[model samples]
Target: MCNAEIDPKTVPHMRELMAGLPTNWGKWGPDDEIGCLNYLTQAEVLRGVASIRSGKTFTLQVQMGNPKGDPVWPGRRGAQRINLMDKGDFICGNGPQTPGCHEFADDLMIMYLQGSTQYDALGHVWYDDHIYNGFDAKSTAGGMQKASVLPIAERGVVGRGILIDMARHRGKDVLDRGETFNHHDLIDAAKAQGIEIEKRDILLVRTGWIGSFYRRDPAEFYTDFVEPGLTFSRELVDWFKEMEIPNLVTDTIANEVTLEPETGVMIPLHCALMRNLGVAFTEIAALDALAADCAQDAQWSFLYTAAPLKVVNGSGAPVNPLVIK
Candidate 1:
């Protein structure tokens, strides 16, 4: 939360900045937890299927347990994998026996569910004692009793994903820290790529931040810790609602700039887009490969599908989204 460049005293609260914005609270139903993902209907799935031209598939999850360490939000460490049993245990005569002359290796991982590329539950963030769909924030007291990632996983997200490579569109390998863009910027990038972002399309915006993380030292990457991405604006929220955009996938840890440049509020879009509008967010996706391929062939639209782990009551779940072109 320590952004050196911005003065905390001058920042407005999320509630204050998001006042008067539209919400999708009852747009689906009172019992709804999956939110705007409902827009990925059967016809949307077929539309995604129809966008396939080259039959090339790209997996968008970053590698977990990389020796060089994984890219995650500051203050959160990378996944740790520890071996429980191996040949050394058997040689030491301390291994458990299953059958005659049988040996096995076992390992365990400790990580934050949101430490990797993940789909955040609508209940993942909130203000004013309520979560998405106006569910009592108390439901999250003991691990998200409502609007957890389980419902989203059960529903699944499959639709036409339009890639807006903002970094490439701006003629840079990566956007500068704290660089901000809006719905108009997204449209401009799409237009530059000669494609249109249609209604109900799963929007994937790449800033190249995640790719740069692996190339630079962790300390340098997290210094001041502001990410370049979509900024908060009433018009941006209106655009998302008007376009019926279902899911927002980005390569940044938080989908938007670390702090809203206008109000100096942090992650206001998380509340405006997820809590209010029920828009699903998939963060930390590895999109460089996909972006490169799209640039090579000039095909930016594809069939995007992701199935996050069904973690009951979990705030978020890691997912390896599959994009087919």
Candidate 2:
């Protein structure tokens, strides 16, 4: 979400100002795929690992299939499907078990590459004809030739994760759909949590919308739920760059409140972070459990690791991110 209530004038003016957007485009080199992941240095990883105390782990991905109804994203396939395989299947499965072996069960999962918790590849977003580093969008016509998920999947991301529970800070069960959190909101929330966000840390914002939607009422969840997410401002963009955060995960799709388009770029956060800043982002994560745990335990930070599927030219993939303390 571009600053809540961006003047219609600002919308039209954004294009001309686009040249000034923050970018790590050439900073990571000409052949950079895993953009900000470079921030996950050896020292940072070791520090994150050292931070672990309780050794309890949390699953950051929501179930692949959710709500038990229509697909979350209309354009893409829905959820996960399991099909009993007869040896060779189009998509590989763990199944086609030994014949007559009831004790052993094997089946293949027809996974929707990105149905639930997932990261956005650096090549995922584009503005008109260009992508990150000013690469022609057509150059990645059939597949992501630049900034594919391959490098991220191979290298993996392990670092400190800081959570900003916006809902609790806001003193509400959840931020209503179309509600937004901006730079000041984040700073204020962090202050309330009594924690400081650090460099190379994975940032996770808990809007509480996901918990409200799934646990309370799916109807209310989908209805008028434009999306309660982050609102991006110039300052927020600069913060991402300044903090050097590698991955930004949120509990909603788009990671920004879905706004009614008045003009150019619809998902401005994606364009700015993915294309210009080369910062990877994950969406639709399950944070309720972790949020509750954080509140009760008063431990908001933890060691984090997210390894996306190593699909050759995958733009992004559904993943099970693990957070341990």
Candidate 3:
């Protein structure tokens, strides 16, 4: 599956990266949404659960239709509308039989599943027609019979969450949309915080872009500064696999540098990590509060769980990741 047209040396990681790209297709078998989640074994989950000493929880999800999110993609019109069930509807009707003693309230949201903070499923990204575990797109469409979000929901994704506070390292509230972070920076940040990259750990990078772009102003976030993100590099993915990290949570739009060094590859890391390797990415996470709490106590990690809606053949869904310490 190597692309021989381009010289291997031309790319950052060389031929080794190319060869590694197409692997893990059937590593866990033909039918598997388990993917890297397999790394988060019972033992790993138990450890994470046990770490919840104080029972303090922080929400990592940005609200639906949050001003911070960009309505750029088609069908991503933020939230169209929200409404509550009228008092005299199906239950009460025009003659309100039980109106005097009626008690009912309901609310609804017309939103894109991936609009706010969300967990992307294996089928969410693809290399041409194939997805993770070598599932062909046509036969394996998501929702029920494919690489759906169901598997992730069933797994009850709980693990140790490690926050690489890039903002704290730089003494800033948020990283500019133009700044880029590399593998070395990830390591340095971890070492500085006295946290070890461990198997099944959920890696969260606080770029601080959430505060600047989404929280402060929407117009400026979309039109202003170049988005600061991950420097395009295969080494980053390699390190993730080495550490057996299954989930990646980031407080940024795309997670990777908007304009990577390689001009053509808009988000090369996405294809490798999600489509090929089956690593789940939780994006647009509002992590400022969590980062501040972690920094305050010099705590770099927490026990966390990200449970997505059980959409049968869903490619992705909004998630409210809970972090407890």
Candidate 4:
């Protein structure tokens, strides 16, 4: 059964824990040092903000998995295409009536994972048995009511977004896959881009990985090529906590520290951001067009908006985020 209730009394210590935190803008607060976890809900979101000055609205979505084509990831099952018409005859008046509308059907595969494109949610990752904002991972997985089950309403996200062009920082158009990015490299790139990180700003990092994936073969995109990603570090978390950023996103496969082949450990960034600080992360965002615009205008911060699909009990959903300068 769904527990459609928010009992602050049950978690009294939570309120006290968050009491010392600054509550600026109330509902429409910007990302802060520790990051804003509760601000994603409808009750705390800002609604009806002023219209965006820019008139452009671009969409960002990845092509779903294909059955006949190569698999998305190794060891994963290939997609399956189904066509209702091919299974049975369209008409059989004397013996059995064929399934209605079978004649007009087509074969297609459904995308099982919603995180294929620009996506975000609380259930996407977990640490210490807790999901986002102290939600128990076991309870949440067992059907307890939580933010993961809720819809990403339109008002939940409305703020200024900044894009850090890592490719530009390297003096190249893009970075290849398997290229590991470190903490100091990000700092240098930010400096080179002349972009100052700010509180409540949505940070978008571009490595040109997405562009490479689209242009090259699937094998080349996944195995032959890789790109630089933010390396997880305790100091980086402290910096974000001090800045009070609410959301952090990137145009990469996973928004965390890429595991070092020598050490063989997963993203430490997830540990610091999601577990320790409760900062939200968005992955696989398409920001090439926006990056170009920012380079031309010499401005990074812009009004941003994203609306995720209303999938119940879903880990994450595909999103088409927009930016208005």
Candidate 3, residues 139-230: lDDT per residue as tens digits?
55324367777789877688888899898887777776578888689879889888876677888999887655545655656674356777
lDDT of 2 by residue, 87-106 (tens): 45423654544467443435
> Residue 87 error for model 2, in Å?
16
Candidate 2 structure, TM-score to reference: 0.86
Candidate 4, residues 174-290: lDDT per residue as tens digits? 775556665567667777777766555666788876655666677655563234677644456567776666677777767653553333345555555654565666666777887
Higher-scoring candidate on TM-score, 1 or 2? 1
Name the 10 consecutive residues with the lowest summed lDDT in model 1. Answer: 1-10
Clash count per candidate: 0, 3, 13, 14
Between candidates 1 and 4, the one scoring higher on lDDT is 1
Clashing pairs in 1: none
C-alpha TM-score for every candidate: 0.96, 0.86, 0.85, 0.70
Error of 1 at 82 (Å): 0.7
lDDT of 1: 0.94
Tell me the TM-score of model 4. Answer: 0.70
User: Which stretches of candidate 2 lie above 4 Å from their native place?
Assistant: 1-14, 66-71, 85-106, 216-219, 260-265
Which window of 10 residues has the lowest lDDT sum in candidate 3?
A: 11-20
Per-residue lDDT of 237 in model 3: 70
Candidate 1 on 1-325: residue-level lDDT in tens?
A: 3334665578766778789999999988899999999999999999999999999999999999888888888889899999999999999999987778799999999999999999999999998888999999999987989999999999899999999999999999999999999999999999999999999999999999999988998888889999999998899999999999999999999999998877778899999999999999999999999999999999999999999999999999999999999
Q: How accurate is candidate 2 locally (lDDT)?
A: 0.77
Candidate 3 local lDDT, residue 30: 79
